[model samples]
Target: MPVIDFVTDEENLTMTVTAEFAAPVERVWAAYSDPRQLERFWGPPGWPATFTTWEHTPGGKAQYTMSGPRGEKSTGTWEFLAIDAPHRFEVLDAFANEDGTPMEGFPSMRMTFEFTPAGDSTRMSSTTYFDSLEALEQTVAMGAIEGTKMAMAQIDAVLQDLRDYAQGKGTRVELLDDTHVRITRLIDGPRDLVWRAHHDPDLVRQWMLGPDGWEMTECIAATEVGQSYRNSWAPVGDTPGEPFGFEGEVLLFDAPRRAVTTERMQGMPVETLNDLNLYEEDGATLVTVLIEYPDKETRDMILATGMADGMEASYARLESAVLTPER
Candidate 1:
C-alpha cells in the first residue's frame, strides 16, 4: 500500500505532494505520458476528466474538462514548459474558459512532477507554485490537497491494472448509469473454474473476504435459479460486534456462463440486482458484475462507501487466490 502526503511551503509559495508507488518508473511514466491513462486518474472519484487536446512537446497546449456529478463542467489547461520523459514534466496549469483561454480572475500555477527510481519502486513528488501566498492558500481552500490525494490513490489501481494485464489478470470498473455500475475482470482460467471460485462456499470464503482483519464466518451458495446464497463476515481477532451478513436469491443461473441475483445487504432498505456475466476471451474468463440500484441517490450512496476501490483490491488478491491457481 502507498500513502500520499501533502506539504506546503508558504514562504516559497509552493505546495508539494509526495507518494511512492509500488510500480517501476516506466509504468509510472506511462501513466502520465499517455493521454488515455492520464484521464483515468487526473480527477477525483466523483469527477471524471476528459482530455480534448494533448500535445507533449514543449509549449504544447493541453485542454481538459472535469465533469461533476450533476453534469456541471470545469475546464482547465496545461501549457507545457518542459517535458523530460520518464523523469519530469513542467507546465503552467490553470483554470480556463470553455474555449480554452485562461480564466481572467484565476491564477495559473507553475507545476513540476518529478519521478525517481527507488529500489524497484518509483518516488513521485509534485510541486505547484503559485504567484503569491494568497494564491496558494486559495487553492488549498478549494480542495486541491484532498482531490490530488484521491487522484493519486486512483492511479494506484490503474497501475495495478497495467501489471495485471501483463500477467493475464486485470479488472476494470466504471459507472454505467445512475443506477447501474459495472466491474469487469479477466480471470486466468475457464468459465467453470471461475464459477467454482465464486459459487463454491470454501473458495468464496477464501477470496471474498471484506477488508483486512475481517473473515467470512459462513458461506452458502445453492446455485439454482430459485435458491439463495448467503455470506457473513466478522472481525478476525478479539472484535466486539456481531457479524454482518447478506443474502441473495438467484434470479438466473446458466451453468458456467452467467448468473443474476437480487441481493439485499444487511440493514439496507433496497435490493440490487447483480448480473454476473462471464465469457471466454483469449483463453481467459472475462467476468463482469453489473449491479443495479433503485435510484441514482442509492447508487451514489453505495459508491461513496468506496466499494469500487474495495472490489479492485479484492480482485487483485483473487489473481493469486483463484485465477493464478487455475492458470
Candidate 2:
C-alpha cells in the first residue's frame, strides 16, 4: 500500500493523507494530471471513477462520476485553484449533482496536494481544509480517511510504465478488494492485433485454447455494444476436463483500446463485469482486465479454479500461434 499516514484534526478542521511511491515526482504528478490515469484510482476500490470533463489549468474545473458496484453513482466536481507543475496543485472539491451543480448543505474542501522527493522515491501529502468543525467531522464520519487511503493505495500501479509493470510477469492477479481483482499480462504484439485476437472468431479460435488438450468448440464474438458473445471449449480425446462455456453482453466496445462486458458461466445466474484495457508501446501490448464480482464468496470461488494459470497459457499461445506469424 502507498499511504503511510492519515490524520484528522477537528480543531484545525483538516484531514491530511500522506503517501509514498516508488516512482519519481514527475511520474507521480503525471498520474494526477492525466484524466485517463487519474480515473483509474481516484475512487475507492469497487467504485471506479470516470472523468467526463477535465481542464487542468488554474481556474478550470473537472467533473467526474464514481460508479458503485450495484448501479449506484456519486458525482463530484473540482475547481482547480493553483497549479505549480510537478510540485503542487490546489483544488476546491465538492459533492455535486448529475448536472455539475453543487449539492446543498455540503461543504466544499480546499485541498492542496504536494509532491516532494523522498530519496529515490516520491512523497505526496494531501491536506483537505474544511469550512467548520462540523464539516470536518461529517466528512470523517462518512469514511473519508479510509476511502482516501484505499484510493491512494492504487496509485503505485498507475505510476509504473506498462513495460516495467507487466513485462515478464505472465498473467498476474491482484486482489483489489473483497469483490474486485485486476489481472495483467504483457503480450508480444501490437494493440490492434491483440484486440483483434480477442474479437475475431478466427483469431480467437487459433489461440484461446486454455491448454494443450483443449480446443475451442464454439466462438461467437460480439463486435458492438449491447451485443452478446459466447464461447465454449471442450477437452480433446483422453483429456480430463468437461465441456464448459461462458456468455456475456458487451457493455462497452472501443476497438483496439478498451472493452467492457458482463460475463457469467452458462446456466449460472451470477454475473461479473469485466473491464479490459489495452496499451501498446514499441510493438508490445499490455492487457489489463479488471473484474468486479457480485460478492466476496463468488470472487474467491472463481479464482480458486486456477484462472490465472489458464490465462497465462492462453496468452502464451496468443503470442506464438497468432502474433508470431503475422510479425
Each prediction's Cα lDDT score? 0.78, 0.89
TM-score of 2: 0.86
Candidate 1: clashing pairs of residues:
none
- Which is the leading candidate under lDDT? 2
Model 2: per-residue Cα lDDT at residue 226: 86
Over the stretch 1-327, how does candidate 2's per-residue lDDT look in tens digits?
898888888888888999999999999999999999999789886567899999999999999998764456899999999999999999999999999999998889999999999999999999999999999989988888778877887776678876777778799888877988988899989999999999999999999998789999999999888899999999999999999999999877768877889999999899999988787876889887889999999999999998888899999999999999988
Where does candidate 2 clash, by residue pair? none
| TM-score of each candidate structure, all chains considered together | 0.56, 0.86
Model 2 lDDT at residue 26: 90
| Global lDDT of model 1 | 0.78
lDDT of 1 by residue, 1-327 (tens): 254678999989989999999899999999898887898779765455889999999999999998653345899999999999989999999999999998987889999999999998999999999899889989999999877876666576567653344344445666755776767776667777788888888778778875667788879887887897888888878855567888878867767866777788877668888878665645666676877789999888888877766566666666678778767
| C-alpha lDDT (0 to 100) for residue 242 of candidate 2 | 90
Tell me, what's the RMSD of every candidate?
10.9, 2.9
